[model samples]
Target: MKLVRYGAPGAERPGVLDAQGRVRDLSMLLAEMGPAQMSPRTLAALATIDVERLPLADAGVRLGCPLGGVGKIVCVGLNYRDHAQEAGMAVPAEPVLFMKAVTALSGPYDDVQIPPGAQKVDWEVELGIVIGTRLKHVKKEDALGHVAGYVLANDVSERAYQTERGGQWDKGKSYDSFAPVGPWLVTADEVGDPHALDLWLDVNGQRMQDGNTRDFIFDVPTVLSYISGFMTLEPGDLVLTGTPAGVGLGQKPQPRFLRAGDEMRLGAAGLGEQCLKCVQS
Candidate 1:
């Protein structure tokens, strides 16, 4: 099922796409599409509802980030071997972990604010895993059971603050509107094989990134298990599996970065596409 949250920011209503492909309001059934409704059991129960009977939702309504209670946006750096080569870095022996502040979360179609003093703004198209069950030190085999669903994400970054600055990567990545996620929260069951999908990104109508998940250096199971080893993975916490090659920073001749008025379009196979514009902060 493709679950959605629609309406103005701070006033979104829970909804789901029906077999006919129309948005069916699910607010009557669930308060908000958050941790409470993101569990496997809850998704299973909701799947049984007759979407046709639910009230209709505007097909063109603004979509907010699909899931609620996104505790922390954990990220994997240079997890793609090809991306590592493009960035002139060695393939990591283990999953390199970092965190994006929850404040960075924003709607897929919203305009991203290019914060003041930031120059090396860039985009990364990634597959995001949304946790549904609490996990701690779980094995790779058990990681999938704890995932509620999957979603598309753009891990927007500022290279200057991320690398040149003396501090950590968080300063460059945690700016508000940096984490644009969701056109939908596709259920895990709906996405049987997570690694067999195509993900791509375009800036101002020019394709900058084109890749598939099967090429990931470490698959979803391994990354999740590895992350849970150090910290508890809670319900509604998000984990970006990592992006593929073709980011601006990896470009040759001259590296390109985002500037005001730039438009970005990105998508993952079966998840959905994202359209975000850049504007001055």
Candidate 2:
């Protein structure tokens, strides 16, 4: 089932997409899509409800981040070989991890604010994995079993703060509205072969990044297990598998960074798409 949250930004209520692709209210059945609701047993129970019978929401309503109670937003860097090559870096033997402040979270379609004193804003289209259960020191073979689902995410970055300032990438990555996630949370069962999906990004109607997950140097199970080895993975934690090649900074001739009034649209196959506009902070 494609679960979602809809309505205004802070007032969004729980919802699910019905068979006809219409947004149906799930308020009466559950509080929201969080760790508790995403558990295998809870999701199994929600499957019994007749989605068609739920009230159809007005198509004009705005969509919000699909899940609530996001605990941590972990990111993997240079997970794609082509991306690593473009950035002039060697593919690491282990996943390069970083953290994006949870405050960076915003509705998928919300405006992306170019922070004050910021230049070289860039876009990264990635596949985000949502954890459903606690896990630590799990084997690669069993890593994916802890995932609740997947969603589309835009890992917006500020190059100057990320590289020139002399600190971890986290400083450049964790900004308000930097992490636009959702449209919907697609369960793992419905997303077969996660590594084979096609993903792309466009800036102001111009296709900038076009790549497939098959190019990932570290696959889903490996990434999850690797991270869990160092830290306990809790429910509601999100892991953003890195973006592919074609980011603005990697462009030839000249770099094309995001500016005020720029727009970005990105998506992963089956997870749905996100349309965000950039505005001055």
TM-scores, each model vs. reference: 0.98, 0.98
Kindly give the stretch of ten consecutive residues in candidate 1 with the minimal lDDT sum: 34-43
lDDT of 2: 0.91
The per-model lDDT (C-alpha) reads 0.93, 0.91
For model 2, the superposed segments whose C-alpha errors exceed 4 Å read none
Candidate 2 local lDDT, 1-281, one digit each (tens):
89998988778899999988889999988877777887888877878888889999998678888988898999999999999998999989889999999999999899999999788999999999999888899999998888888999999999889999997999999999999999889988888788999999999898999999998899999999999988998988899999999998999988889999988988889999999999999
**Model 1: per-residue Cα lDDT over 105-206, one tens digit each:** 999999999999788999999999999999899999988999999999999999998999978889889899999999999999999999999999999999
**Candidate 1, lDDT over the whole model:** 0.93
TM-score for candidate 1: 0.98
